[model samples]
Target: MSLVSINPATGEKIREYEETSQNEVEVILRRAQNDFLSWRKTDFEHRNNLLYKVAADLRSNAQRYAEVMTEEMGKPIKEGRAEAEKSAWACEYYAENGEEFLASESVETDASKSFVTFQPIGTVLAIMPWNFPFWQVFRFAAPALMAGNVGILKHASNVTGCALAIEKIFRDAGYPEGCFSTLVMGSDRVGELIDHPVVKAVTLTGSTAAGKAVAARAGGALKKTVLELGGSDPYVILEDADLDQAVTACVTGRLINTGQSCIAAKRYIVVESVAKPFEEKLLEVLKGKIMGDPTDESNDIGPMARHDLRDELHDQVKRSVDAGARCLMGGEVPKIKGAFYPVTVLADVTPGMAAYEEEIFGPVASIIAVKDEAEALKAANDTPFGLGGAVFTDDVEKGELIATKVIEVGTCFVNDFVRSDPRLPFGGVKESGYGRELSQFGIREFVNIKTVYIR
Candidate 1:
């Protein structure tokens, strides 16, 4: 596919970009490798200063950058602004904590003194998605750059503008030229890039299929990789849960970014005693949601990032309904001009249906009624993808018990929706992908752990 930015809200081509030629990519690899020699030697204070500068620049141009993201990916303007702010937060987070995270540690060895030290491992390749363009890239950039490794970004083809803008952010913040670069290229070129001598490791945040392809190539080359793939996270509501708060959180959790988030609550597994009331309140809250142009401040649900995605999600919902699932609300695509799908709620969903089996990355929630807590836990762990999950209950001990019992996820939140924080490691298990990002654990992923000894 060509590298271009097409506005999903209006189906208009904003701009087209030429993909980087093989020769140009080689030059980038060479430059990044050469620059790292000097960049890795730079003082931690200098690196911290550059990170602070990046945070300031992101905040200064938040509106313009957010608008670019909204235009390129159909994210609501409010969410777009929030994304920009979050990007800045990540920059600041690494700036404050990275040096300490990478500091040498003393260890007891047979010698007089021995310790472990963290060091950069040359250049890294980051393959990112478009859903939260700025935030996703910055999360990787902040920690990796602070750890003294340069980055070459292979962002989603449709978010070329956002990709270029991010490259500029690092350059403007005084990172040496080529310390960070964006490669406007197709998916086919990624394998070649991975095998390049200068590219030492890879980090990817995308679908399961894409993750597997990249991991396979990186594995053959013996390069380390961190993969954050798709998720069919469960949002369980127990009988003792706070119905009022649970309903409110579900609405926001299930529909954030039009339910396109990997951590969004896709499956709603509630105990039968509370299922009826929860479903009723969920529909009532969903009815008030406004779907339209992302630029509009009042619009809650925007168009899918692309037309094909909307069609695919619609097909999944249709198949589920045909296979004995009942639509609780908003089953059909809205009569809108762009790639719009209504916020659908499906009831009586079973494992055999397409909706239950597939990751429906849209504004659709599948409700599965369970007899009790035992069955609820069983239903939640039934998916192949286990990126993130949430549990709601008034009893803290009960919530914690259920949280621990659920299998196949990176993080499980009690009485809240799944979210990423700068202080905690985030990743997934099973087909969802391996490795971690964010927090101290994330910074260590791209570094070389070296042991030093003294006789």
Candidate 2:
């Protein structure tokens, strides 16, 4: 079987990569095991220097790498470039803070001297997705490598070019040949890695279904795992919310990355008193947007990562509309050559409808009106997903109450949209999967924290 990358913007085949044979997979895993032995012994200063080198490499060739992302997944050129910049930042962030994060902590014990030390495990398998292809891998890889563990990436097949390019970046920065490598393989082969003797742990950034499968397999193998799954994040708008601020933030949050993000604001729960005005302005902003070839600088939206993904999104939209949700704006799929989904807004969305129930991974927004603050909080926490959410209101005290006390999500913003940051931990709760990424906590995920004492 071949791994082919098709341009969603033109339905054009970008390239095809040969699949790795079983024997080759064995060699890769063995090499990673061997690499870990030496890598884990390296000093923090050595790893830190190489991290900065990788960051410089990404910045120097950002545009070229960004084009690969745009060609493969159809992100706007500008956003793709920004993704590269963020990838670089992840490298620098780990470089600056990893040593302190992994440092041994002293504990008061009856024994004269006692403390806890962090040591690296062996190889880690990263099963990443195509959306935000570059940032996703680097966000995991930077800290994993910084903490002295090697990685083998089984990235989304459609973004194989990106996967290989990342390998090159690490090698160019002077990492050992086997320290990081991309496996040009299919999803079925992920189990081979999980069950391998050399692989000590696993991490994934994808769907809820995929996360569950990986978690089950890793559990069976007694391997550590970190899974980041799905989200139907809510953006709660209270009656006291500033209409102008709420409208702008919601529009940007819903339309970011064409709404393909796991943490993007998919559901907007608005209080009844503010629903009419908020909906009026949101529709105006979404309708006035331009979308086309991602390479074009003027377009705000671009084609989804693939046609089938876009088709699935349209199907979700269709079901919601048929179930009585009203389409205030572009809910219809474009009858064009590419996999472009329109800027869609589904109003009067209620519980039990597809729009309100499922994660609509596209440029679609669902507005659910509520009678009061209590109902608004209930609606925000109604979904099975508990990834990320936001609370928008002019009353700072009220926004804090909702964001901190009410929303049952991993991360919630008081007056802004939800996003991942290098400075903070990012992940989800409930069926959204377990474990955190980024920041000090993320760098410690793959390390073995052993308690030590001297009598």
Candidate 2 lDDT tens digits, 301-331 = 8999999999999999999999999999898
lDDT of 1: 0.91
| Residue 221 error, candidate 1, Å | 0.4
What clash count does candidate 1 reach? 0
Error of 2 at 289 (Å): 1.0
Show the lowest summed lDDT stretch of 10 residues, model 2: 397-406
Q: Residue-wise lDDT of candidate 1 within 312-400, one digit each (tens)?
A: 99999999999999998888877768888888999999889987888989999999899998898888999899899989999998888
Model 1 pairs whose backbones collide: none
Runs with alpha carbons beyond 4 Å of true place in candidate 1: none
The lDDT leader among the candidates is 2
Off by over 4 Å in 2: none
**Most accurate candidate by TM-score:** 2
Alpha-carbon shift of residue 127 in model 2 (angstroms)? 0.4
CA-lDDT, candidates in order = 0.91, 0.93
